[model samples]
Target: MQKPLAYRMRPTSIETIVGQQHLVGPGKIIYRMVQAKMLSSMILYGPPGIGKTSIASAIAGSTKYAFRALNAAVNTKKELQIVAEEAKMSGTVILLLDEIHRLDKTKQDFLLPHLESGRIILIGATTENPYINISPAIRSRTQIFELEPLAAADIKTALKRALTDKENGLGHYSVTLTPQALAHYASATNGDLRSALNGLELAVLSTAPDPKTKTITIDLPIAEETLQKKAFSHDADGDAHYDVISAFQKSIRGSDTDAALHYMARLVEAGELVSLMRRLLVIAYEDIGMANLPACARTVNAVLAAEKLGLPEARIPLADAVIELCLSPKSNSGISAIDAALTDVQTGHSGEIPKNLKDAHYKGAEALGRGVDYQYPHNFKGDFVVQQYLPNNLKKKQYYEPKTNGKYEQAFKIQYEKLKKLLK
Candidate 1:
């Protein structure tokens, strides 16, 4: 039996690795270290299917150091001790621990003394942010290398190899991928080579082989069926990022619960950070303004709590906050109103500060009729002295528009009406 395309097509040498030229290319930091035979303890941080485990394996194979692999998810303290004993006998051992973030503090601490002694070189791999997930003491002692997603071109090359390389690839079958079909596969994976190859293999294997053509054509529809989900259509760097976020914000602001949740699900499913979700929550308040003041507080608390609780459990609190924010009363332009007023002053709408509002420390200002005609609101009846606060060029501009929904807005509306009546 032949190995799967993903396993069979694994790059044995650094040169064959699809992505991450920054770390392993000629004269790069890790490349130089490896060439000099001075590889150090390190951490490989990246999302799944980005070659973290493969890179570690390649490093072990290329180096002369005694290599031992352990998974923090399965290995216990006793197993670690045994590995340490082996390292002691070997003098120099390279330990590659996968999913190192799963290790408890005690297990991580167990490796500290060995790591500090320079006896065992440790290389840890994690999908989470090292700053938050890993212990600071351990992180400080290791060099961190981040691996980026494989480019579409890189995935295409890997796909070609999978079709041609017989030992482990799809060489046994008559498979010819069309340009459109390959694009579909590449786009579906979103830079995950494993996913791309798996999808391609399934598409090719399932189709009936034609005797005259002797080739299986994998179309976009076939690939979609195999993958089950459409690829993320938005470009991460382009306007699509902002557009999606704007839609997400608007959905929440408009009180469209389904639309808001759908966008949230899209972001989360795309592997967006919890921190980004928290940021959107803050904007919901600043944009929503007084209409939903509690949304801001709720969002802040969710972010802080998510940091402590971690996912997949932390997702619950985040979801709660998202739903609450979407349902909260909406308001428009509190921060924007203040910002617009400041812009007018800076743009020379007001040539000088009002003398009444200016600092009293300027002695000449009082002599030049600077301190004139300013009514103090607190000293006046009902604390409601009506006076012009805007620049002369920008008068009677309304900034805040509160939506008539939810209890908070109702209360605000009542107070605003009462204040208007009293001032008149």
Candidate 2:
């Protein structure tokens, strides 16, 4: 029986691999390691279908080592022991452990000594963050490399290669993909080569050959049908969750509405409402600041409404809040101002308060010369009499640098500048 197209088209050499140039490109660490045929235990982590398994396979093929693949979800300790025994006889064995985060204590304990004694060279592949899922003992012994999603162009190149490789690909099928259909597959898979390849195979094999040309013709509609909604491999409890949220907040802070909406949709699809609400509230005050106080209030209300409504319905209000916050003027001045003040306090900036500024209403306060010449700001013009408010050590310190991003903050900057001159 023929294997799946994705499985058949897996790259067996470093040169054939696409994307993740940071690792596979010439002179890169992994490239060098492969070239030298000297590799230590390591973990490859990222979202699905970005060539983690292929890299492991390529490493074993290039080095001429005995390679065995096992899934932690299905394979047992007995299977691992078999591989360990084989390694003892063969000198060294490359074990490609998939879904390694699921490996239980028993399996982990069995593999620990083999890993330590250079018997099993473990290449752990995980869709989850190793730091959170893998045992610290295992993590400390391995270098972790994060494989990113392939770009559309990279996926396109791989697709072309697969279509023409006569020995292991769809070359014998006479499949013809239009440019539009090809682009649709490349982009619609959202960097998952597995999804793209599977969709391509489905489109080709399911369609009848055109009688005149005797060739399978794949068009945009067929491509769209095959590759449904872009596959999102976001695990709400994993690094992808935090990574997307971080990008979403930064996009809003950077005032990029499109990027903010993109990340927001990823979270929405993953049903991460609670985390979305919490992050939105934080970004509103931390990034938006006092630029538009009303915008901040609206975000809070939206979060409340989203919580009550829940998913499907909750996504609407959350999206509404995201759009508003992205368009709002951004300012980090508030955070900067507070942090500056905190630094002064933390660094021993405290000094005695002025005698006139001290409490004088107590019985003996007047005799002690406190409040002798305190100026009442309420009685002066603009309700802003010049007087020392900070401790002596920080008398001239100025924080709260206002931004002029929006009309509201423009007004603030003007007023703040005027007050600075008057007070000085």
Candidate 3:
């Protein structure tokens, strides 16, 4: 039996490689490095199926070095040392460590001494931000080449190659891809080449039973059926992190209790940590502002309870906070008011400070009538002195507009009324 399309279609040379032109294009840094045989210990940081491993293989094949591949997920420090010793015997060894970010600081430190000696040209791959996951010492020694997701056009080209190239491709199948079908496959894979090829292969194998007909057609619906379920909840990196959180925040903002709950469930079901959920809860206050002050308090309480209670049981406090935030009366611009005031001050929109509110220690300032008209709120009727506190240009600018239904609204209304009567 023939090998799978993903395996069969692996590029043997740099010329046959798909996508990632930014790294391997004519006159690119990687191209120049490969050509000069001046390759450094580097990290290939990117999403899956973007030719990281393939590039490493091509580099090994093109150069005069022995290639050694190991997965950090399965390999141990002892195994790494063994490989380093082997590289020392061999003139130059290109050690390709897949998912290198999985190594903890101690395990990663094992490679530093070997890398410093130039025994092995370390080529590592990771789906995460190296700055966050990789050890600082190891990271500083290796140059990082960021690989991007394959474009739709690149995926299309790959599909065409799989259909035509006879050596390892599915040329014998006589499959034809419609533009719509190609787009469906591309969109479904989200620039993952292996996934795209797997999806395409599945579509062809399932749909085309007879190769004698010499024609096969694939559509979005068929593609959807073949790729029935979304493999994982989140995309590579944290691309979906902000997206999921945004949806959660918006659901609460819109006061859709059910929607809020649903989004909360999605995050939890997707294996998002309770701590991240709590962090988002805190942001709900700053973003939601006085529109729902209870939201902020509830969020804080939920975080504290979650920390104390832990998971499963802790999920309850999180859900309660979400519901409370959704139901609470909303306001706007509480935090923004302070921000605007500060911006005004920085931009020179500020005028003279009220004498009573200013420093009282300045010599002769009090004698010059600075505090002559100042009225202390504590000494006035109802503790309500309606004095001008804003700079001259912003005196008429009302920053804190209270909502009509919340506790703050009631308090603000009462205070405003008493202050108006007292000042008059």
Candidate 4:
């Protein structure tokens, strides 16, 4: 049976690999390792279709070592045993384990001895951040290399090469790809070579060849239809999920409405409503606090509506909240002030509360000097009075440094400065 176009086009050697020049280029680490025949186990981390597996396949082909592919989350311990046995027989073998972050203790334990003996060179591939997702046991045994996305020019080059490749590509097919079509394939996928190549194949096979020339002419429209939506994989547990969430928050914090909406769209596509709502609430208080008090309340209302509505419809309120938050004035003084106070409390710097501020409701409270000499502010003119609220050790400490980010917070700054001067 014929494999998929993507699988068939896998490069056999490092020289043919489309991207990842940092590692696969001449004089690079992988190139040097293959040239010296000094191969070691390593982990290749990056997004899908960006050549993590290609690097592993190329290394195996270059070194003439046995190559085997397995998914850590899908393959069983028996499968791992087979690869290890082959290593024992063949002197050495290269095992490309995908989603290595999901490797369990049993399979990992079995592979550890073989890895230690240098019999099995493990090439772990993942879309997750290894430092956060993978266990230390497997991580310590392997070197980690991150793959970068293929450039548009690099992808176009690969696509052109595929068109002429008869054995594994569409060389024999009577296909005419226009310049506009080529540009769509290169740019529409957002630097994904696999999507572009395979999309080309689909367009070629699906389109009808003209009766006269017997040529399948792929135009811009066909290219767009073939790849209507770019490949999206947002595993909630993966690094991509966190990366998008981080971007969504930072864009809002930086007051970039468009960028915030873009990331929110990705999260919506992944159906991460719970995470989205929770983060919006946090951003409201942490980033948009005090500056726009109404914005904080509106964000809460929006989150509640989103949680109650759920999905498709839920995105309506969320979109409204995201736009408002992105445009809202940003201030971190509230969170910053609290964190500073927290740091002091955590470091054991919390001295005793002032006697005047201590509880005095109990019958014997006054005997302990609680609430003694307490000047009631309400009984004074203007209903304002100066008193030491903080403990003696922190009497001079000022944590809340208000900013005039918005009119509401500006008023706060005025009042705060007035009180500060009075206390001094």
Candidate 5:
């Protein structure tokens, strides 16, 4: 059986790997490790099709070590044992274990000894974060290298190489890919080189050659059809779901409109209406708290409108709310005030309520002196009186410290100082 274009085009040397210059560039850790031929257990983690498997294979090729590739999602303990046995016979075996996140505990335990003994040089490839998914023991034992998405220029260079390589690519066939079609594939795939390469191959193979010239032509329409906008891996209930939401909230809180919008676009693309709406509401109250009352109300109204409209149309209202919240003045004084009060209550600092402030109309006899000293604040000017609201022991404690972030909070701060002096 013939291998797929991507598989066949795997870089056999470290120098040929297109992207991730941070790792595979000259004098980098991976480059140095491969050059020195001193291998160790490590994990290469990133998104799909950015050359995790190719890097592992290329490492083995460079060092001229025995290479074995296995899928951790399916391979059994017996299969690992065979590889381990082969490593014992052969000096060292470079094992490229893909989907290391799904590797069973039993297999992981079985491979620990070999890894420590330098018998098997383990190269685990995973798209998920190793810190989140891999076992702590394995994680501690391996050097973790994070790979980023490929740039458009890198993908373009790799595509051009494949187009002209006569051995494993579509170079032998008479094909013409216009510059527009090439740019479309490079950018539209969203940093996935595998998608770009596969789309290019499909565009060339599926198009009929012209009778006179016998050449396959790939234009913008063909490129668009072949590379139907790369679907992002946004599982609603998965790690990506929480990651994007966290980034979204942080961006809004940090007042970064561009980053906030990027995350919002991801949520909108994934149709995550409920999560986005809830996050926006929380940001309005939590981050934008007490800074601007009207802004908060507007955010609440926007959330309601989004909820009523549903997705596709809902994203617009939510985006409006997000931008408003991002640009608005930020203050967490409301949440901070409540948290301080809660802490006092939970940590035994809460004291008894003042007798004058207690409920006096609820079946209280006047003889008990419950309402004897209580004076109605309405009778005083500004509905204010010099009366103790907190217990005697906690009279000096202040909870709400309004910040001068927005106009409303600034006004509150000025009025609050005057009121504090008058009450005292």
Candidate 6:
């Protein structure tokens, strides 16, 4: 049976592997290891179709080691033993273990001795974080390397390579891909090179040749139909989900409306209305606090509207909120002040509250000098009084460093500085 174009077009060497320059670029860690032939057991983790399998296969091909691929979850311990037997016969064998996070205890125990002996250079591939999911015994033996999602340019590079390579690609077919069609395959799949290449193959094979010209012309519409415009799904348990969420919040915080909308669109496509709603509320107070009070209130209203309307229509209100959030004068004063106070309390810096501030209504409270020194701020001028509010240890500690980014915060700064001066 013929293999899929993606499988057939796998990079057979480190230099040929596209993207992941941080790992496989010249003078990078993986490249250095390949150059030295000192291949160590390492865990490569990232989102799906982002060169995890390619890196493993490429390393084995480049090193000329007896390479064997097996799934840790599906393969039995006896299957691992067969790979071990091969390692023993050939001195060293490069073993690509897929789903290493799902590895059972028995298989882990069997692989441990071989990994330690340097007889099997274990390359564990996973979409989950090895530090969080894999056992310490397996983790301690391997160096973990994270693989990033391929760039759109990198995806395009791989797609072109597959189109022109005669041996393992669709080079023999007389297919013409327009630039627009090529971009759709690269960008629409969300950095998945495998999807782009497979989409290309589908476009080429399914398309018919021109009667006279005999050329299979793949236009933008054909490419889009072939991939059906892959949408990024939000997996609640997956690591990539959090990464996208993080980017969403940060883009709004950084006041990049375009980027904020981009990440928001991704969440919207995944039907993550609840997550987007909650994050907007947090961003409103934590990022836009005091700087634009009206924007914060409007954000609340937007979220409420979104909740009532739900998706399709929910995306509208959510987009409005994110745009205002991105353009709002940003401040972290509210969250920073609370966090500073929390740090002190958590670190045991909390001292006793002054006696005057204690509850005076309680029985026997007057005997202990509880409210004896307390002044009535209502009776005082400007409804203000100099009094110790914080614990004694934190009397001089300043937490709220207000930003003067907007008119609202400018008014707050004036009042805050006056209060500080009076207290001092």
- Sequence-dependent TM-score of model 1: 0.58
TM-score of each: 0.58, 0.65, 0.55, 0.62, 0.62, 0.64
Model 2, span 1-424: residue lDDT tens: 8898989988787887889899989999888998997788999998889899989888887788999999998999999999999998999999999999999999998999999998899999999999999999899889899999888788889899889988988998899888777776666565789988999988888999999999999877787678764223322222354578789999998989999999998877755565678899999999998788789999999999997998789988888889999988888888999999888779988788899899998899988999988999899887878877777777778988999877788898999999787666
The clash count for each model shown is 0, 0, 2, 0, 0, 0
- How do the residues 291-382 of candidate 1 rate in per-residue lDDT, one tens digit apiece? 76777787878877877886556667777877887777666646766777688668866654555665656668667776567777899777
| Residue-level lDDT tens digits of model 6 in 59-141 | 98889999999998898999999999998899999999999999989899999999999999999999998889999999999
**Model 4, which residues run further than 4 Å from truth?**
230-321, 330-424
TM-score of 6: 0.64
In angstroms, how far off is 85's CA in candidate 3?
4.1
TM-score-better candidate, 1 vs 3: 1
What are the root-mean-square deviations of the candidates from the true structure over C-alphas? 11.8, 13.4, 11.8, 13.1, 15.5, 12.8
* Residue pairs in candidate 2 whose N, alpha carbon or C atoms collide under 3 angstroms: none
Q: Which stretches of candidate 1 lie over 4 Å from their true place?
A: 1-3, 64-66, 89-91, 231-424
lDDT of each: 0.73, 0.85, 0.74, 0.87, 0.85, 0.87
**lDDT, model 5, position 339:** 95
Q: Give the backbone clash total of model 1.
A: 0
| Inter-residue clash pairs, candidate 4 | none
Clashing pairs in 6: none
Model 4 C-alpha lDDT per residue in residues 132-193, reported as the tens digit of each score? 99989888998889998777678778888888899999999978888767766765565578
* Residues 161-205 of candidate 5: C-alpha lDDT, one tens digit per residue: 988989999899988887777766665555678988999988888
What's the C-alpha lDDT at position 135 in model 1?
81
Candidate 6: list runs displaced more than 4 Å: 230-329, 332-424
| Higher-scoring candidate on lDDT, 3 or 6 | 6
Ranking by lDDT: 6, 4, 2, 5, 3, 1
Off by over 4 Å in 3: 1-3, 104-109, 210-214, 229-424
